[model samples]
Target: MNLSIFFEPLPEALFGGDDNPKSVGGYIAPFLHSFPDWRSAEVVLIGLPEYRGTAGASEISFQGPNLIRKELYQLMKGTGPWLVMDLGNLLPGIHLEDTYLRLKEVVEMLVDEGKFPILLGGSHDLTYGQFLGYEHLNKTVSLAIVDSQLDMQENKDAAPDQSHLHRLLLHEPNYLFSFSQLGYQAYLTPTTTLAALEKLHFELFRIGQVRQQLKEMEPVIRQADLLSFDVSAIKHQDAPGQQHANPFGLTGEEACQICWYAGQSDQLSSFGLYGYRPEFDHRALTATTLATMVWYTIEGFYQRLRNLDFQSNNFLRFSVGFHDNPNKMIFYKNRQTDKWWMQVDDLSGQRPPMVVPCSYQDYLTAVDGEVPNRWILTQARI
Candidate 1:
């Protein structure tokens, strides 16, 4: 775990005037702040420099962790009371399989101590390894992936790559509960892949729809056990350092908001930020934006954990349901409201029923006899 080899040569800007920098082969030392028990801190930063995946991201991604770390230190300088450690980057040239195993070991150590793990990526493909970390814990975890493209590729015949999502979903069944894909767009994601997602009934949402109703999207975010963020999901203007930038995607602010919301949830345990290249960025805006996003996520998580009291069921409530027909008609009642209802087309989509507001109790009674798999809900008081 001696990390001095990596940080010994670095300037004071990187070390922040700490005792001799701790050194690790693949990891950089933490730029110690004024805190003494920092090792017992809540959040640990792990950098993965393995950039073997994607078309041209690997070479550029070597700079990802450094840039983000620098920017974060600058932007969050005055912010008091945060526990973080920069564990540096994973060494280059290790087999992808081996790298995954090592990262898993690191994450497990962090989580067992009630600490949150924040990983900075070499590429989006690192998610496969990242997710694997939870395997030994045997806890069923949900994935919330924020990316412009569906990294779920059909083939896993080669080394780990952006298509890592496909491998994770197909192979790790017991370890995973559900995967929520966010910031998806019809233009960036291939039609065939989107069709596959539709077939799977996996939770997927376009960025536009999310912006329209964040209230509804909040639940989907809270349900995640781990959040993997691909910077490409942010608009090119806001996150231009990414290898493949989407012209119209989430703004940095919107992405930060979503990250904050997810971080606030008790279910979320870890997060990883991917696809940032320092050299390609102009004025280091990309790195700064990433650092800020991470800060917000951490802040949100701490705030919620403190204010909401996870042990209490204060925010828990049940709401209305609807059923138009025993077999055909279905209704979605908002748990948050007494009158709000979202109409569902008949199971076969062949019948039309009058859509109207109804009481939660009435909606629940209608569907009392049967269970429906899919529907919509609103927060309107009927």
Candidate 2:
């Protein structure tokens, strides 16, 4: 795709002078002297320095990508064959939409080549670009977003960072199959917005709900093809670098755990971490936090398992029959990973019955002669 023309090489000085052979910087093939051979890499890192999507277009935000790189490079490397590449900073285009187009092209190329793309960003609005990458993939997509507030602002004239979710949800061609929002603080989210998502049969996890049942989020994340995490989802104390840092949100550790879950998902193809502002950072604490999240995600990626084969002996199957409905619900639990899945009849009748990721709780719910909410939602969508 001739990607070199769209990116600028990382500054030599940003490459930490850490001499330790085990450091991540020593292992990654950075685009310093020349473009790294991304074709041979399993994970590719792209730095987005475009802040025009937000108000005022702050130039200070341009340094955000490198700030994260500085902390990331100093960390110790994870388990073997670290085929990672730093593609350096992506140069913003003349217009904000133009920048989005550039990002869409890069992501489409990388995903088409079977490589994971992790976008380190200047603003959350770039997720619109990330979503656009899947437009030509010829398949439906499930998207998971983690943020303090739903970005689906009603004002059409609002900045893209605030209104991008609206664009994503209403995007033409209707390729989005599912959308889930995690770690949203109720106080920050309006009831109207919540009701709107409910009408669409989408899933949402309030911040309190997420903290109370963190493990339950795994299946929701596992269902996603793309994930966009806004740093505002983290408490201001843990990530003070965000422009709109909230006092209450996910902890740094919780954020990393979510990233780990996303990384391990067999369906997830691209991830974007956004809303980092280096100018507001405190002693680089937020930078370190984001870097560690990236590290955990990469580690989880290496631990990823291939698609499950239902007929195999590695899974245990269970059947729960309904008395009144005369339909039986079938469930499968992975012996190796302990993940659960349930079979649901496609109400649309256009395709075969779909097997979707579920939680242990859902299986238990079905055993009690009740249909789980997950099953209801999946059917409603169909």
Candidate 3:
């Protein structure tokens, strides 16, 4: 793949100055060139136009990059201080595993230059590749996944829509830290899969729980090293543009809050917004909402990034939950003082950041013991 020659079309609204953004190897060349000589940038927004990993979403998701870009441009017409470069699409036709490796290479290049990668995804399956890319960053990578379904299918060949996550789990990378599964529903997941995830120490939070105990959800998001959002996590009513639209899920506001939390952390390097189907979206509301979510998430991110009080604490938190009893479980935060530590939570027991305004009752509910609130982190410095 001659990455330097990839041609990507950007929204006309994204144009700035005399130098037009370039198109490089299936990516946006102009966006890549927008940074200060590629050595430093606040964040890089790239679209993964490839949807092959998702059986039902491949064709419809091709419109994802363009749709999100259009919506984002409109939302941030006059926004400031959030330096974002839009690198367009990781196209289809490549092998799944190979695609993962290629995405890894691209992300590694950006990380090497110290640019945070904000991917507008083709599907949630891309997380495997994103994680693989982080393996070489010399930093621990925590995963924050917001989705209604766990995608934890036991059957390897079940529809790609339902199994992208299962494939990711199988290829656990060395730098992979904690995995926080948010917005998952009880019915969408099975008892066996839940048990398996529990044994592995992955964190789980239902949409209902977050709605009930919003404030406590901040720790999980803050503790993540990277964030991955599948729009299906939002309800079908709220965002029906997804291939796998779930009726029981987060509202638009709640979905945005999750992204806001992830954006608050300086240590949270990589971020993505995935799973939008322009065709299924009746009123084009889904694409608009998806775009808005990206902006709000970025807004939340920049708000924290610009704060003078912002501290750089790269902690990875893993939450475990009981299937029958969601409250009966453990909350683990792995803070590496020196070297990059992946899977460190299993070996060491570091404490997570304490909730300042929240009490024990609030923490339990936020952690799956109770229902979630509309607003999760109200006392955030940003």
Candidate 4:
């Protein structure tokens, strides 16, 4: 229960640099000096300094959270209560996988207390810990990963970061209800991997599609219980901090928008932003950009309206039934948020039907007498 044992405090200079008492950093309480009474806090920030699993990652990442705080502390905090606290960085384990295990326990502890943990650090493989956190708590969850390419390698000897997805999908207790990936670059993702994901019924939103219909992704992020963002998904120009910087990827603004949407989601419980290499970050632009993303995420979380009642008056219901099928597709639109959900019937008698997050576009698809994309995928999984 001594969380400090696994964590190292923010560098004295980083947290104690300025005498100015008005910046966002001024409002944050590091668990190093003060263990936040998480019951009173809405969100917690934690950092990890591991990158051993990444193919060619560096030890410079160990200083990522500290560098991010340099920029984060300079940002302005919103008007409401400052319920955010930082737990510094997780002390690395003897083995890279050991760090993952430590992170899982830390995340589980915070999640159990209803504290949303925003992982402001780590390699792409760190999410395996985030996913394990849910398993440790015995909670089934949907996952959303924002990356440039699929991290599914068929190589049996692949490192933890390379084949983490394959390992996660095969993880036991089978708590992964659904998995959605956003901002993957088509050229980077292999055709075979795409086919495999499609066959398995996971959702993949290409970078071009997301940029064109960015606003529509709110419902998609809302459906997730945890999010893992790989900085490599951002273009080299916008986020050059990635070791595997892509020439084509999301812009800084687009990334912030996605994080804001994640923050606004009622179902989102955990978040991890990974793949930032400070050594490659010129002028610290990527760090500042990440700070902005985290800022918007926190803002969205504070502004959540908490309306998710599909059967209540807050939602307007519509049903589409075709003469040929004798089955109905039910859609619910929330009056408060204008978000949508759909009911997929479970005919197998094994489990009850599921109402999953959807967008107006899906409704339009159903109205055209076609199967909605999300519904088809959900059914395939069921």
lDDT: which candidate is best? 2
List model 1 lDDT by residue over 296-325, tens digit each: 876676655343321234333233343553
Q: Across residues 124-207, which tens digit of lDDT does each residue of candidate 3 receive? A: 778777777777667556678888778877676776657867766776455555577887888888878888876666678887
Ranking by lDDT: 2, 4, 1, 3
- Judge candidate 1 at residue 5 and give its lDDT: 27
User: Candidate 4 residues 44-109, lDDT tens each?
Assistant: 888878888877655455688777878988988876576888878888899987888999898888
Task: Give the poorly placed runs of model 1, Cα more than 4 Å off.
Answer: 1-13, 18-39, 57-61, 77-80, 155-159, 306-382
Q: For residue 381, give model 2's deviation from the true position in Å.
A: 1.3
Model 2, range 134-183, lDDT digits (tens) per residue? Answer: 99989899999999999888786788899899889999989999999999
Of the pair 1 and 4, which is ahead by lDDT?
4
| Superposed model 3: Cα runs more than 4 Å off | 1-3, 11-40, 57-61, 77-80, 305-382
Candidate 2 residues lying further than 4 Å off, grouped into runs, are none
Give per-candidate clash totals. Answer: 14, 0, 18, 0
Per-prediction TM-score, please? 0.75, 0.97, 0.73, 0.95
* TM-score comparison, 1 vs 3, better candidate: 1
C-alpha RMSD values across all candidates: 8.5, 1.2, 9.1, 1.8
